[model samples]
Target: MFKTQPYPHQQMAFDLFKDKSYFALFTDMGTGKTKMLLDIAAYKYNKKEIDCMVILAPKQVVPNWTFIEIEKHLGIPHTVAQFRNPMKVKEKEQIFNLYLSKKDIGLRILTMNIDAARCKDGFKCLSNFLAKFRCFLVIDESTSIKNPSASVTKNLLKLSRKAWTKAISTGYPAPQSCLDYYSQMEFLREGLSGFKSFFFYKCFYAITKKIRVKQQTREDEDKPKGFGREVTIVTGFKNQDKLTDLLDSFALRIKKEECLELPEKIDIPQIIELTTEQKKVYVEVAKRCMSELAEDQEITVTSAITKIMKLHQVACGHVKLDNGDWIDLPNNRLETLKNIVEELPDEKIIIWAHYKKDIENIHKMLGESSVTFYGDTVDTQASLAAFHNDPKIRYIIINPKSGMSGLTLVESSLNIYYSYSYNLEHWLQSRDRTHRIGQKNNVRYILFYCKGTVEEKILSALREKKQLSDEILNNITNYVKEGMKV
Candidate 1:
């Protein structure tokens, strides 16, 4: 028995099929698909059935596997290769060292980003790495290669032939059209759809309209080609039920809503210390805060409020420019949050941000897995429903001021605050979103605050249920009177 036990659905998925040469796990995000696949790999390596396993995922997600998943789940000696770039000489030597030091090792796992597949060096390095042993290949977020004409898709399709066993996994495999599944199915089995190429597969099932269209000759220009009657547009799909059945045959699909009986809410206070650059910036900002208190006696109340907001934003990692743009600063809050997210078990997470830019930055990092809802979210109800009902949506980032009340999001066992403001009502209401009825698990609240900064002052005021306007005035007055800088 393994130290980390599998969920019931995971166990059933593993038990249901172990003999397939190529497989697919079309499971939702936060449902532990990576662990299930790694468990299978560990079993094969232990039984001497396979000697090497190669995993590919999005670039940002590669570190989660390399530093957290592989190290914590399987404890396997693996190398995560950097593919997109001018590869460093040291990185090349590091990879070669791992390749050569395969003594008494159960299995050698080489992980890389999927986008790396397009580069010539990425193609050659992965091609050579796969040729050394009896390799098992797994492509995480397999939908990345859904485009039939994409260079990465073609590269992965060629590499798929080199492995004895291969697998691909994605939450929404056919996102826009059933046509999206063609390339993924082709990777699984050469003729799984009983068609050789995407053209034949689409022709067999799509309702197409042949129409001529103008071709682009250059930037900001369009002109009809000499021959313009060769184009075909898919008007609609045909035989979707049959397509679903075809996919159902090889893909092990599971919905988190149908499977997980999660635990109670747990609160975590994630304190991020200032980086070296942040520390320098903090001193400057602190001096400005004091200067605002001492020299800006005649400024309007609105200006005072704006200055306070700017100071808070600086503490949270970015400073808003006067030109309606933002300058990113060196703040440890984002990095701390990313590391904490990777260390935890995959579960639906809710991150609350007081600043809108904080919400945007976090969502950009997680891509589609995380959604943002604030003043900008036009369809709040639809966004709420998707976060509640859909398992693939792993995060709901809320500006608590906008989404604090009138919503119940008990699906999340963890709630993180990338940054907080001194609105006591907003904080109380946001905290209740995940602690309401029907929530069986303890909610975890992870708050990021920079030490020795104005952020702690706001947090203190919030804790005491005091208003920020009053607290800021009083704190500034006392600090100046006491001749203190911080």
Candidate 2:
């Protein structure tokens, strides 16, 4: 019942979990987890086990499942509907009602962004559908619900209880900590982690300590009346063996290296010399951040992140002013990117940038030779098709957050990071877009950063966190302060 032949690893994963009621695919990016999920759905549909399938994924990824994945992998005749907007309640209900009225024996597939589940209308619509049909629910890139406190996570957990079967899929399941596994597991099946609440789960698996610090008082508050507050911080993890045993029971964990003989992933750091204007702007932002840090005895994480993001933005050639306007600073980074593009005229390249302005600038520089995949791109699937099929379209400019997960771009072996965020999950998932199965040539990753700027500091932190698997943003204040020294 499969349209495409599965890889050996994919076939094994399918055989193992096809009949399971609840499971997780901790498969590496570019390893065809999507195909495995579709194969399972097809098997169940053929057996008359499920009347429909509901896939909840990131906004950009939701479209691809309907347009590309199911069309490529599933052999069954199915009716597919994509819920793009959460505000269109009436339209969504009509689609669901149409599906309910249909008496066809074919599988019915509904795809929607996980964020929609948080909205009242979207949640009610999906709830009603689940109430009527026996659904095989899947959450792709399951990390979106890793936060237990998020409204979307809570709503999904509740909705998951309605499905006949469920699965969660992601390349990097626990990006920051073992704590990330808590809510994702709970979404698959409540108390899957052996703990009912995140608070107790954290206490069981995380080694934490409490420290007292002077609390920040409001400007109008009396300073003498302020008291210290004790905060609990995770020092490390515990019970790893038990957690591994639990996950191994229901999760198929596979890495690219273990299952596939993929090409080498070579990382190259391309250091650029900042222009006079760029250097001046970067230094000003760094110094201002240092001064602010010096003045604030207790800086909130949000304030620290904003200050660091300002410095990183300046390093990336633009700065957002107090009025929310972005002014470009003269920088050699774009010129360097052009030079690299010219040097590889015939090669298909993927250029990743953090900002929309960067994607726009790169798109303009490449002109007709480039297609863009970002949040603002009107037709992401069309852009993806052009990149995959057209030889003349040699460049794909993308924002990592939007184009990072659930994509296979083996057409390009070279990926240039014009800019990137501090999120390690984005870095890892984006890198695998070209390096996954079917890649013949060695994958080359080029990272661009300005010397003696926040860009360099950000790269350093990313490297360290990539190795350590720690949260990079937790140390943003230190990165900003060190950038000023540089």
Candidate 3:
């Protein structure tokens, strides 16, 4: 039987961006954002419509789109380049050569980190190119634009007027406060022009308080206090069901859970065959983690496993030492994770890690085949697109702090916890990447932990707190509603 694909919700995202002037596809992460973007690009290119498109993204993931995500999903062939190393005169010349005459090339894809975009030459060149071409500009994970003063943000808006189309894609655009929404919505041209600045938007949905604080009653000072006004917390995007209809006019968006029917849990283990010397250190670390960390600590299987995972990190080569510095050890966790991914039987998988060091090391090990979105990859939309693209990615190593909450990674059922983090919020959001309602498979989380450590203790505490968190959230929602009645 032919499988029915792209559940209704996903199809809607695809249709929403077909012809809109400016809009955003705020689908959750793990949703099929990458696939939808590919389809949109292909549909436009095939019609001989647009000559070129530029996807701006964070540095870490710019490589993912050029090397992996685009090739894997789009039917159209496109030339892609990384916009880093622009300071090198030779590299700049090469990039210029690729950008020459889009009429000859179907789509000239350029990716630059947000930092480089802040430079004078980078901003000028990008602005000039967009002004010359009939282009579609997409900013993925658009929250990076929330800071109105950022040069990249200013440059993007300057270029936006020249583009025939513009779109923003984000999973959680407003993670912190309503104030975050102003700059994002302003870039999308979704907010009122009269409210031209972030301050104006903040004033629209915020209350101010003047306060003076005293230490030992020695001094008093006056300062402005900001409080959130009644705002809609869109756990999902607004009018989600109608999203596709809206996008068909300008762009397309898809959720992974709603599209690809894959496995629920992917169990991958990086077998770290320790060198004889490293093994000795690993055993010692494991012994200490178990006895000292878990002895007085109330532990569960999950917590015990988590501690071992941290101790394993010490063995693998990288560990956050007590003094806040990360030390390199004789460990192979990074390589092991890659090996486990390499051996996977050709299925989609989601790999989660806790630290930036791990993310970069894992990226090095996995090569350009995978997409990474964490703090390192923040402030760009292209990285967001790479994550959403339908690609044969071996791993998606992310910091729970950055990759968690706002995204949906439900495209692959096999979730591998290569390492654990300390934040309960990040843990919950990361797990939901696979365990959300769109999933049809029995989801399983395979965690790799050392035999013992504080990491394990943290994981245990988070697990217990998770249940309590749900209750607290529910209570908060009710409280907010009741207060609104007054």
lDDT of 3 at 119: 88
Candidate ranking (TM-score, best to worst): 2, 3, 1
Which rank order by lDDT, best down to worst? 2, 1, 3
- Top lDDT: which candidate number? 2
- In model 1, which runs have C-alpha deviations exceeding 4 angstroms? 75-84, 88-90, 212-230, 262-486
Please, what are the lDDT tens digits per residue for candidate 2 over residues 1-486?
679999899999989998999899999998899999999999999888898899999987887798888998999978788776633787567476546665684788888888999988779868987888889999999999999999999899999999998999999999888999999898888788898799999999999987554565575344553345667877788999999999999999998889899889888999988777876777778888878777654545456667877887888888898998989888888899999989987899999999988998899989999999988899988898899899999999999888888788887899999997867778778888898878999999999987776667668777665622233346656677667654
Give the winner by TM-score: 1 or 3.
3
Which residue pairs collide, candidate 2? none
Candidate 3 segments exceeding 4 Å error: 1-10, 46-49, 87-94, 190-194, 211-398, 401-442, 446-486
Task: Write candidate 1's Cα lDDT for 1-486 as tens digits.
Answer: 343777888887777555667889987555677777887787777766777788888654565566567765674544444443566898777667656774665567777878888998888877887787778888887877889899999989898888878888866676446788888888877788778778889987899876544332344144323333246666677887888788778888887567875455455656677666666665676566668665432333344556666667877888877799988888778888788778865788888899888988998987887777887876665677678778888888888767653355777768888888666657765776666435787678776776656677677677666656656644554433222233
Quote the lDDT for 270 in model 2.
98
lDDT of each model, Cα atoms only? 0.72, 0.84, 0.59
Q: Estimate each model's TM-score.
A: 0.55, 0.91, 0.56
Q: After superposition, which runs of candidate 2 have C-alpha atoms over 4 Å from their true positions?
A: 86-98, 210-222, 225-231, 299-301, 390-392, 464-482
Residue pairs clashing in model 1 are: 263-441, 264-441, 264-442, 265-441, 265-442, 265-443, 266-442, 266-443, 266-444
Positional deviation of residue 12's Cα in model 2 after best superposition, in angstroms: 1.5
Question: What is the Cα-based lDDT of residue 237 in candidate 1?
Answer: 78
